[model samples]
Target: MEGYETGAGTARQAVKMDMPADQPQTPIDEVIRTAYDNIGLERLETVRALVPRVGMGGLSPVLLNKIRPLFKHTHLVKDEYLFQQDDEVDFVYFPENSVISEFQMLADGRTIEVAVTGNESAVGISAVWSTSSAVNCAQVCVGGDAYRIEKDVLERELTYSRPLQRWLHDQINAYIKQISQKVICNTHHAVEERFCTWLLMLQDRSRKNKFNLTQEYIAGVLGVYRPSVTCMAKSLREKNAIDYVRGQIFITDRSKLRKMCCSCYSELPPRRVF
Candidate 1:
């Protein structure tokens, strides 16, 4: 926090971080090292592999080392507030091993997640688009590491670099597809449909059928009571729709799940949720 400048046009407060030779490197250290090795990072090694439907093999190697140097490594523990509502946006983050959720609280005191970003996605669009200071309440749901850059620097790179710009467009398009599907699901699907669709989406991202979860976390995202999440999860399991144990939910019956899920899952053709 000390010896830092908040903003200075395209310029950022730069400082060298020392890795002590005496101390062993942490997991965060390894992620940083691996990121340098693989321009295209595989999803499994990232910390955010806990969630489903978030598997992203990001960046081609040529671009990986090229762009990797532009980013600074950052870490956030679980449940930590990354950015509060109305905070100024300085850095745009591409999470390598973390899951960050963007949500808004309603007047009735309910919170709804607008987007859950990790491997395949980019964050801080409003900063680059609006060029404004204020930001929304985006928190860390899963603890992990990220590559961060100043907003101005990111925009400048996107503007002049055609390859980076194309990559940005592709990433943004993926998110647009997701948000569009979520809208359709929220409006027309039944509760069971919505639940399955959500689970399937999570699975696709995390690249795993089994994941750590709490009923309360599901309830928060679904905008329902904790008990409701438990009951519904129980319902799905009883019907062999899924298997839940020790914070792990496994979908054993994909056939039944797709049947039970709304058209959003099957009809829309998700990117990689199979």
Candidate 2:
């Protein structure tokens, strides 16, 4: 083999590095171009519709433009993980006709939902204060599209926009308040009452009288056994509070449903409060 002698009297063989030609091409400017395309005039109309729902509609034209460039449209599918617990938070999402659920995993492999975010709110709002990770598992509870912005870009803009900062802070406070109240509700409320409360919350967020949700998923969200959830569903059905067929739940009797729920549902702040 052909070799070269070094000054140290060591011989080294010549080598040729082989690289794959089919590797994906990712140019620096490609991201910028894609973002521009995703936020085009047609999409800007969608953003205009969402900004108000997420409580960012009142931003000044200059600020809105600055922030708008940071956002890219996103589609969130059902049962998809936006981010897992303790995962790095690279982006914060603003739901537009979407619902995201936050879940806390227990030591015994069980999980319970701590909160839900919908069209009128933002997901991963805690990213603004945290370092770069999430505290809970975030998933798409309902399939829909949204807008997302990098944490760094949003943080940079937050430092310069007083209105945006204040609005986000208010939203964070509201979220914390919701989680705290759920703690008390789960501790003191009955399973049937809690079940009703959960349905009402889902109804409010989806803005629909009916949605597809199985009893097993409801059990997981409620942090109860499957049998318990089944019993509660049967009870609700018997009381004419709701009609559960297969995986779909229909709120046929809204008044009865509300009456069955604990006061926690009404006591919580409305979705648009922030």
Candidate 3:
């Protein structure tokens, strides 16, 4: 616990590496190397911050301390399924720099992304109030670290904290808005516009301009064919808005990319919730 800081009003300790430092190495660095070398303290700080979507933004420090122990840090890989449709909701995931996509499965074996979650929001939050199975498949679209708390543990904690409960409800409302916008965008916008919007959203969540996304993956998320994604990528590259090589896509000109996006881009949530 040497590299960790105890919350101001609670005995709970959280990783403190997020603090800015002028020196390249300090006493905190030494402690991190000695005590938390294997955990990657920087990545583990996702749970330590008062992130809004994680439902810790406005809670009292004492309440945060009581529920902090319920969370377990996890590293999620791209394309890994956090929970499949119809599966029992076991845990809720709080992505740090990672990105998770909730896909609605169709009977024709197609999957379309309904919502994308990042540090601004959590995944599988519906489980907090319902004991039913998952409705959509939640998968890690970008590989990175996250924190997860068991559904039952979070449910129990919510029962004791009104602030946490209100936070969760707000997150749910935001999530619904996101899904609704996706529906409108998919129905009314062109594929090129939708593609640009999707890329921007991914960049917003992952905090990276370059993404290791294959055309196949993009097609699946957009509910389009591989050839269509290929065509759209080619157009974006020709316009100098983006560049793609093999499985990677790079946002080369953000301004140009934004220009290509439809109205949906502006309708989406801000980069940060709090």
Candidate of highest TM-score: 3
Off by over 4 Å in 2: 1-66
All models: lDDT? 0.60, 0.68, 0.72
Q: What is the TM-score of candidate 2? A: 0.74
User: Model 3 misses residue 16 by how many Å?
Assistant: 33
Q: Which segments of model 1 are wrong by more than 4 Å?
A: 1-58, 74-76, 133-136, 245-256, 266-274
Count of clashes, each model: 13, 0, 0
> What does the lDDT read for residue 192 in candidate 1?
74
Overlapping backbone residue pairs in candidate 3 total 0
Worst 10 residues of 1 by lDDT: 1-10
Instruction: Compare the candidates by lDDT and give the number of the best one.
Output: 3
Off by over 4 Å in 3: 1-66, 271-274
Whole-structure CA lDDT of model 1: 0.60
lDDT score, residue 94, model 1? 72
Candidate structures ordered by lDDT, highest first: 3, 2, 1
Which digits, one per residue and each the tens of the lDDT, describe model 3 over residues 235-258? 877676777665677776665666
Question: What does candidate 2's lDDT look like per residue over 18-72, in tens digits?
Answer: 2223324754233322332234223334544564443332234565577787789
